[model samples]
Target: MLKLKSPQKATMQITRWVSDLDWRLLLLIIPSLSVLVFLSLSSTPIDSFPSLRSFIFNHTLLTSNSPDFVNSLPSGVHNRRESSVAKWKDELLRSRMAVCLVGGARRFELTGPSIVENILQVYPNADLFLHSPMDRNAYKFSLLKMAPRLASVRIFNPKPLNETESQVRVLTAANSPNGIQGLLQYFNLVEGCLQMIETYQKRKNFTYDWIIRTRVDGYWNAPLGPENFIPGQYLVPPGSDYGGLNDRLGIGDLNTSKVALARLSLIPKLDSAGFHQLNSETSFKAQLTTQHVPYLTKRVPFCIVTDRRYGFPPSRFGVPVAALSSPGPLSGAKCRPCTAACQGRCVAGVMRSLYKGWSWTDWDNGSLELCNARDQWERGWEKIFDKVAGKKSASVRKKFADLKKKECVDDFNEMKKRVSNWEAPPPEELCGLGLAV
Candidate 1:
């Protein structure tokens, strides 16, 4: 039926069939071959293959033994970063710094020498500007004669502040014992100092590179280190948020200082933002955020020295007063001189139980000691302060205690002479507040 093909013809047909099969196999394997070549030549690792990288790395890390893979990196990597930071901080030392000290010199005898020894002396080139409401205790501010560069001084009589409707509406009267009027007056005191700085800068035809806003009564256990002077950000102490920034201490360049110190002027802005029942700290934070300025917070080695009384083993919403002698940076925590009733584990448990957003600080590490602040500063607290404050600071306390009225007036006159601008009620009214003629 069919003629048989010749042997040669049959062989050629078989060869043709083999060639066609090879072509079909090549088509199927070419894609996989290309992918293999691409991966082999890639600059990135196999784990970074674009599609599976994130999923792969995450799963690998979870199954791995190491929890801190980044920190487990070589020490040299961290050391270089630290070295760069140190170099940057060294450059900040050359910038001009202005120390703007505000608030009353209520316990200047206790707080003054420390300021001189810590802040003013720490930055010998920085000029001192003191703005305080005149009080009987203000005579103690005469110790500022020790400051190397005294610039401006304004110790004025406290008069009622003319409150704007905005100020009344924005500020809260609850925590403020002096009521809404007291808030206005206090705001005037802080903002008034800012005005002094502005006027001084304009008169001199030069602006400060930095402005340090601090209270008169803050006790610093350490120096105002150059680390606080960040170039583009305002610096404030950490903790004690109290629904806002810790307004107790702030450091910034001139522009930031202007905004921060515009305490009274910013009230209208707060009102516009519909903020009410705002305390000092809350309002301070609002002003900065609304203005779009950046700020940074770190643990500072200073605390607000206080004479106000608080309940011992404070309940929630109660303030825990620290002892002055407690080894602390304090960081603006309320403190007074007294025999410590709580220390070690007692302080830790109390601080731990309290709200971190409210009156809490680094109380562990023996940095805090609790006082039975249910009463006034304990009798003979001065002796306790002297023993802890060291010799140089203690000598200052004695000098103020023994100063007579005429001597006080003479000292203030000398202070006035040193200051570039002097604004106050008068030398006699100043001396008569604290000294008996």
Candidate 2:
């Protein structure tokens, strides 16, 4: 047992030990190297990486889903994203697109110019469609004159929709501000935009490759980036899913868009399937599911800017209102400007308290801020708005806030000159109703 080894024998023994160490290292490092290589090669289109994409896009919770990982990517992944986005933009440039805006112009004075600059101008080739109901504040829509293009504009006073038996059975009156009647009116506006697009295609003997349906009250903080144009998927903003997908904004190719925009026409189909008591969001999910449309969710760069009051530290069933300045796409969350009533750990506590399946939004990584909306928007909401929106947008807001009947009429006239397929009541009537003496 105490025998000493010869020099050559000891050397051979040491070489064997070194060889064993190398094998162990290879066993440990091989897997990690494979993973690194796989990730690096995943620079193809989204369709190329179905397994990884499928992982991010969960099966339950209303179809497929994915988050915008734009901010958190490593430098290589970030560059890859830019390359992917460039490809999307290239496809868009070679296609026809329609950008539809629906609903009332409640806060349009503040929201309109941003739409013109951020969306309409950004996709200057995409035709614009405006379908809004006439209201006392309708004069504010005159701001859309700055739009790069217009396919159609219909600002009409809505007659009450006769809620069919199917509508009554399927759609509940709860949570709707104006009840089932209100839902119908909103649905009509959404569907009406599709109808208008169809009519335009018929008139011009052409078809659109893409349809982007958004709201009139939505404010855009940045451009609707090219990355969202998934060929086979309907893209809706993430969060604010009130027992349904966010209906606030939708983007899709022509085939998927039809299934989405057919809000009213699909109700009969929903009723046939024995679905009832559905809210707008739930009904939206049902429509797409039944139609076999695949959908994707990404953080869109817009918010439904609202003046409606909501409670702070939103209760289990209550709505969480975001501050306009919250560095969010806000993703269709109702937002208003005020000193944040909640943020940081406060946001964490409040978000935890909310029903995640209900009116919850993404509040991670300090991307969200809250507004105390129990009362009216703060007394100096203008100053707060101007500060958040910066000088260029604030000047546009001031222009509309100071809009007179004469100036409003002038703007409409200018729009009439530029807009193709303009379909609406006269400028005088539109201005007259909103600015009556």
Candidate 3:
């Protein structure tokens, strides 16, 4: 109906229309092309993808230390990967380690030499950090003079800590001897050692690859092997879990250890997670899980040397005590050096009666022997300890029992000489902690 447009204008309009249509077509076609390419790539079998398979198997040693992981691999592949395994083990031995000892020196005379012999000397290069409360037993720590290296030692007089409302809501005093306050004190002891390690690292301008934390009251039956130093995971001894993970004897890389070692500092995080009425063990487990840290459990060759008594023929919730003579890596179970009260089928029957997660440990075969720890350590517990702990450890016990202030001062002085950080009271003050004024 209108005047006819020029041929050049009409041609230009047609050209613009064609360009828009081509772009719309491309939008529809490109996605389909991409889908087809993805389908084609995904159809290729993983076994045929040599580069992918090689990456998983080759880099595993740098990442994984789980024996379960190795066993899960193809049978023949494990044998071919032996060299990788050896290399990881070698790395563990050479890695810098911080061996942190925490708790009161209640049984330092008996436990100290074993720790020095099995843990400290076994990893002679590892620096030692000890944080303990000053008690009548504080003088016993003089045994640490035998330790090859002492990085830090803190012996402070303990005062009652003020409890927060969150601590009251989140913690339970059910099984603790000192109630919630007891747990707080123990937590402080552990966390304090971590603070010391941090200070030492800053002072020296170096980071430890691994941190090994154990109680001062623990008696080691064997050396802490290189296998326990998992690269990215926290290692804990199995069993004795009361609705949570074992809080005793933890080993890990510095990152994981930081979370594991912050026993007291992480309680607020637990409260935030809605954890209520948790005991130390449960609180400890909650701390790790809340922080998204991974942990693994293995049988460690140490037992807590406790003077506290537990019921024999333990009920569903009762604690089972072990005899030190048991040919075992007892894994931090409460133990005493005494004649076995239960063994063979007697042990099997009693152990079977107890809940595995609550109070029981792996006591299969003839590996475990029980103690009648109900009463005070039998009248002559010294001989029993000596007989089980051997002549060398026995001699150490005698030396501590007969310790003089002069000798204690001399011993601490010697230990101080080897230490890199001596953050403790003077040797004379430490030696005379329990002596009468």
Clashing pairs in 2: 244-281
Cα lDDT tens digits, model 3, 188-262, are 999999999999999999999989999999999888876676656788989998879999899988989999999
Worst 10 residues of 2 by lDDT: 56-65
lDDT of 2: 0.80
Quote the positional error of residue 32 for candidate 2 in Å.
18
The per-model lDDT (C-alpha) reads 0.76, 0.80, 0.81
Write the residue-wise lDDT of candidate 2 on 87-143 in tens digits.
Answer: 757778778999999988888888887888888888889999999888877888888
Candidate 1 weakest lDDT stretch, 10 residues: 54-63
The positional error of residue 382 in candidate 2, measured at the CA in angstroms, is 0.5
For residues 329-406, could you state the per-residue lDDT of candidate 1 as single tens digits?
Answer: 678888877788999999888888888887777776788998998888889988888887888778887888888888
